[model samples]
Target: MSFILTLANLLSIAAAASGWLKLSDGPWSAREGLMAVEDASGIVMVGGRANLGLAAQHDVWRTPNGSSWERLPDAPFAGRAYHAMLSHGACIFVMGGQTVALLGDPFFNDVWRSCDGGETWDSLGHAPWQPRAGLAVATHNGRMVVAGGCFGSSIGAGRKFLNDVWATRDGASWELLTANASWSARSGPRLVDFNGRLLLLAGEVGFTADTQLGDIWESGDGATWTLLTATPAFSARSGHGVVNAGGSLLLIAGWHDAKCLHDQWLSEDGVVWRMVSNATWACTADACGRFDFWPVATSSGLLLTLGGSNAYSTFGKLWAETWALPLLGGGRPLRGGSVAMH
Candidate 1:
């Protein structure tokens, strides 16, 4: 970006925050389609969008700490954004994500696995479904469970969403968990593994611009699913960041009511919900598809919002800020942000 753009960014933060920006750094840049996976070793931010006209970049970067980023090997597949990825055991499993245009644009349904800590990646196999994005992925009992997400570019034009549920043991391998269910055939739903069960929350469906709905789905064996939370705390919205912590589930920062969300909600049993963003995190963040959209939970018990662009505009923004979200005491950090996005 031009030097003037950089100056404008500084001013925007000054305008957004009262005076100073309480910013954190990472391997910074403006890209999307990337996702991060964190562990004890460090945080790994993988492939994301590079430009509006350019294809997504598969390059991966690592930060031993959340501050500095080191360039790693690029992903074998074409660069993509809005893709779903999770870290399991020794490998980071990256599933469906949209192409250069963002969610549901260049929908990618392919499967790839990274064992060498995001340095290198190998194609696992093709997903049973066609290339699609905005899908949710979670690992349970050594199996990866995927749900929701749309199939086509526009919602109702030619695209279809998945109420279908599926899981896999190895990336090359696959299994049919559910043919159809009650869940919405929508993109950008939140999926997280809590305790021994998988919990799904929020998302839109059909050609309609449906907003928040209060419901949560629970899956134990991946094959059979149950409606766990009949009552929800917040209205359904897409592209929100959801994570499991201290045996409790926390949902934060997403597009809700067609606008970005600043509220925080917590679920103890993955059903009973309550608000928690009382003391920290004042500004609303962009939904999860863009750079700095996703949040990583640290072992130190702090929730870190990863970088993207300057809050004011998209031009010449820094993908380096990591805003800290204060959480109540007693919960250990669950996951660190590793993947990158433009």
Candidate 2:
């Protein structure tokens, strides 16, 4: 009889803990592309350019408090835009961005790493992702997963929108996970980890008479992808951001047909999608929102996003946005919120 009572108590404890995780918010918020990196310490964001043209730059930001922000080290890389960065243990690995040469034909595959947080960066090596723009990457297990981006002879016309998956641990080498026609050939798609699995969600493809897709997919491994959701969440979007907020995965705003979208969604499994409360917030445009937002987990247990660029404004806006949903037991579905801009 005593053993039965003990078993019952243990089950109760497990159920309560899971419920706490479901309602809690992990670290979250928007930041410039260069400044963002996820590690055990928190999220760190590095250098970013204010305009479209690439001219070597170095600026940085980091967050431990969801409500406030702090400045970190300026990156050492020559100024470039549309680059990718990820966190591994104590180091943040950054790769693939646009660097202007003499004729204004700008693109590169150089890789770098930052050890002392985001304060400084060191050149790692050449990347194997090829010269591309609006490409997306996310780190999982011991490897960095990369897939589907735009590259080519021309900036607009004849651009190669890809559907290939690549993974690397050392920047000097790359492993092609899958190159099948299975994935929707896209650029600017968001890559993230959901429910212990990897997911590639939403992006754009084609030019001239353009095209875009907001379709969602998930994978156990980086290779074969499974079609989870066929419909686009709000509209066909690209250049938008997604991150792990609280315990649930959150999809933030991005560009759709040259217009900006602020609609949001939440996923526990990442396959089934649900629009969450206040998912669509602001309607604006600029360079900052083009990449992933830096969501850092804090000691007080809040998720935060700092300042970033908007597509419409020349003088970019900085933010202290918080998805401060109250801690409720179990997963109480909070769906749909007003879409507005501050």
Candidate 3:
């Protein structure tokens, strides 16, 4: 028994020592790719830029493991970018986004859902809110919530930043939670469920220069929001991915000061934060940064950073590559039991 125990301990140590988080290329490629949540089956990648030209794509793909990707049938809706996708109950819902065009980008308030995984999709028609993109959407308090985005045809052209909050039990019907929340109008804010509460992280405030945000907001009910911190530990960033890892919240890469960031931060209570990794991976235009990359927690408890653009404002520099890291304290075996590395 002593000999067996010693061997098991050595194996565990070996696994941990060799298990440092590393970024590897996923099977699928996209100029601009976005990852949906981990459903009962697996994780899904939604619409992205398909080429160097300013073209939005409506293709859907799924993967059980990040290495293997299977493309689903093309979605019914037109191609779009900077949209929000979430899984709720028996269906996956996709909402507001903008389609690239030469004249001006046309935003959509239309919502759609897929019951048969990503095999097929059904339109839920237009949402009550005005057409917009870069909005935050998530499931909170037994309902789906959509909040804070930009409503404009193009950047700096009749652009309007929003802070309105809306909720829906069924994807087809939406109720206004608040016309205006306490948080300032912003786009690309990280809206995620943490500690059974809906938390909003930093985003871009305006279309003008020097308007990124790093504030945090919390809410039990969708209507009332409390500002947790006006100034967060990280600098003002937009398009960052936030996910609940174990019990703590992890903030991934984002856009800051005309540059795509590759930093990572973790927080226990949302107010206090600590930077865990610095430039573990730098998402550049060619290599792809965290800009607009939707980070999803896999069923195996790994952080999968999906498709996103390395270009902050320009199109055609989308990344098809996927990168993942284990959750905090996730590499070790629990107690005395041996664990397999993902």
Candidate 4:
């Protein structure tokens, strides 16, 4: 009996040391991934393209352990993609993205809030900023700040990119922090609140090849910005996910030069980045190689990534699988170490 107990303990340790675990499949069929957030109750997924027709969806779902999912009612607005979903205090907010249109996709400046943990939503009316999609947003110092995205239809000509910044304490009203910031006009940059400040990572400028950038910027008040590095340690890529794991920040998978990247990086500060993982590449869609998918940092210090897709039918496939990695303890990098997967 003692030997059997010892064997069980060893197995448990080995499972934990495996680095990643594939949890149960999400309820919905794979499509373009949505923005996800974890609150006191559980993790909530909101708004993304559907797998059937590639149309935007307004469905909301929640999960406690990533093994099971509970689908909430549809949101009060039309289906959209590239939107932002964040949890602040007792409420979860969904803001700005483009809606599926037959003629040309129209951008949205609307903001919706759910006070009872995504059970029901109320439109806060349109935000003060212009309608846009692929903007980076995060709650900083008890206020939400939005920065940089592309406006206009992505399919044809006349597309406009922006680098403007705005902030709001409440969802209804907003204040323009800056008309234009130092960073170039871009879309799909990864934004996060780190150490009470806002950090913006790499993003793509125009809808074409050779437009991705690896710049990193920091802002204290969202008005004045500081360029941490014009060129970062990692390659230039858009559609990546960033999370503040403990005091350190982690950058997840994104697309770089037609390749779907599976590499991950970590930084104690925003400037110096170190590659930590080189997982296998899966998707290769030009518009949605895991784009717009948000990674949730759980209460137990484990990071969870839900459904995502590449959006290209041939190369990109929708995913319902859940991936997890433990980020507590000394999971951070020890400065100046060689780039190696953990």
- Using TM-score as the measure, which candidate wins? 4
lDDT of 4 by residue, 33-120 (tens): 3778888768888877665435788888888777678999989898887888889878999999877676754788899999877889
Tens-digit lDDT string for candidate 1 (173-275)? 7787877866756676777888888888876664243645557888777666788765686766655677776666777655444454555667678777666
Give candidate 1 regions above 4 Å deviation. 1-26, 50-55, 101-105, 206-209, 278-280, 284-292, 308-320, 326-342
Cα deviation at 243, candidate 4, in Å, is 0.5
Error of 3 at 137 (Å): 1.1
- Candidate 3, run of 10 with poorest lDDT: 332-341
The local lDDT score (0 to 100) that residue 306 gets in candidate 1 is 64
Compared with the true structure, all predictions reach lDDT values of 0.63, 0.58, 0.74, 0.75
Worst 10 residues of 1 by lDDT: 333-342
**lDDT of model 4, residue 116:** 78
Q: Compute the lDDT for candidate 1.
A: 0.63
Query: Distance (Å) between predicted and true CA of 177, model 2?
Result: 1.4
Error of 1 at 253 (Å): 1.7
Q: Which stretches of candidate 2 lie over 4 Å from their true place?
A: 1-35, 40-42, 51-56, 66-73, 100-105, 153-156, 206-210, 278-301, 306-336, 339-342
Q: List residue ranges in candidate 4 displaced over 4 A.
A: 1-18, 280-291, 311-315, 330-342
